[model samples]
Target: MMNDEVIKLIENRRSIRSFEERPLDPEVLDKLKRLTLRCPTGGRFSVIEIVDQSKKDKLCALCENQVMISRAPGVWLFLSDMERFYSWMKEKKCAENFGESLNKPGIGTFHLGMQDAIIAAQNAVIAAEAMGMHSCFVGDIIENYEEIQAMFNLPKYAVPACLLIFGYAKSIPTSPLTSRPEPEYVFMKDGYKHQSVDECEKMYEKNTVSFRERGVLPFDNTGSYIEWYYRKKYTSDWMAEMSRSVGVFLDRWLSDEA
Candidate 1:
């Protein structure tokens, strides 16, 4: 039912961690930047493309020393940025109209900005894949929240939403594409359906098998994949830090006293 260029592109896309050392063609890079900016947005956001070795090194450290950050030849940080808008409002002398309330962006603004940034980042990733470049989304940039903000000298209203690393693929993957939940398990005909434990297990059966084959699951496989994944990801120290950092960013963005 779906046989088209877009469908083929979507089907072939994969998370590529390794990349070639060569730089992207200048024209391609420029087009990518333009395409990212053309994405739908609720409000203004920002992009910081890191090509400099020094900055990439710093970003690598901030993203928990992910070597891929430094090796990818390009690292793009998409940010939920209200700083420019706020500054513009102040420069236009409209800050007094909203008074102190203008200083606080509130949760709504934050949510909008986050959506804008993430959507734009996804656009860039897809565009890169079409242009024959592979990309990986590193969400760990939010883990070192304060340090990342300091590294970029970002204001309270400007928060990092995603980090994208892209370059020419080192090699095409020989293995089959990763498995996913069946269509029935993922899509709903009308309303949401909360699956029972057995249904959930059945849904994850393929994923569990694939992970085990790929050596992604624990060696011992003591408990169910759900429990293993929950402890490894949801309750891991990295996730804890990410949650804490997001909380701090949210507090700063919504704090009228700040």
Candidate 2:
């Protein structure tokens, strides 16, 4: 069984949009940075803590005017950074021994970097919660890769992995926790289990009911909650842009055009 304090902390975690008009305590910020760095990683990750209001405003615009970006007192951008590692290896003559083909980053490197950065970001989230702060993830930060890369002057080996903002919540949330799929459907016994459409609907019944109650489902009886979300988020223009942006960034990372 989970510890009572751990259970309570995980259960209470939620995305916060509204924050009080104040900065984080200096001691808390120091601890937050330390906690973020302590997470496991395959390689080093870079973190950019945004304190400059001008940069925050630009980031807000880049993320499709998510007003919360501007309002949050603590903003951070996490990167799957290989440039620093590559430079170190070069300085130590280790990278030069491998030659260009073996030294340049590949798809595997990118994946590892993303894992390291995202893990660090989650660590920051949990640590912030423990310190009496709230946080929200800004996934749209991946939608404008070129502009963001230019803004931060990122190298080809450093890709944006996650953007997180933290602050003290203005009010406690009263809404129920979002529903999740049943354990049977999520955890397989041995192999992949493919369910029929009816089974899928059954599995998502709780989500459908919750969405309907919150008025998130479409007014016209066009489709189920899953279909509505598929159209609303999965196939949205912003998602397409995110795909395009990431493709561009990947191409640059994989290119040999030093």
Alpha-carbon runs more than 4 Å astray in model 2: 97-102, 219-222
lDDT (10s digit) by residue, model 2, range 194-240:
89889889899988887776677776653577887797899999999
Query: What RMSD, rounded to one decimal, does every model reach?
Result: 2.4, 1.9
Model 2, position 154, has a per-residue lDDT of 93
Give lDDT for model 2.
Answer: 0.88
lDDT tens readout by residue for model 1, 8-115 = 899889989999998888898999898777788876689988878988988888777899999998799999998888788878878677564444456777778889
Question: Cα lDDT for residue 178, model 1?
Answer: 72
**Clash number by candidate, in order:** 0, 0
TM-score of 2: 0.93
Using lDDT, give the best candidate's number. 2
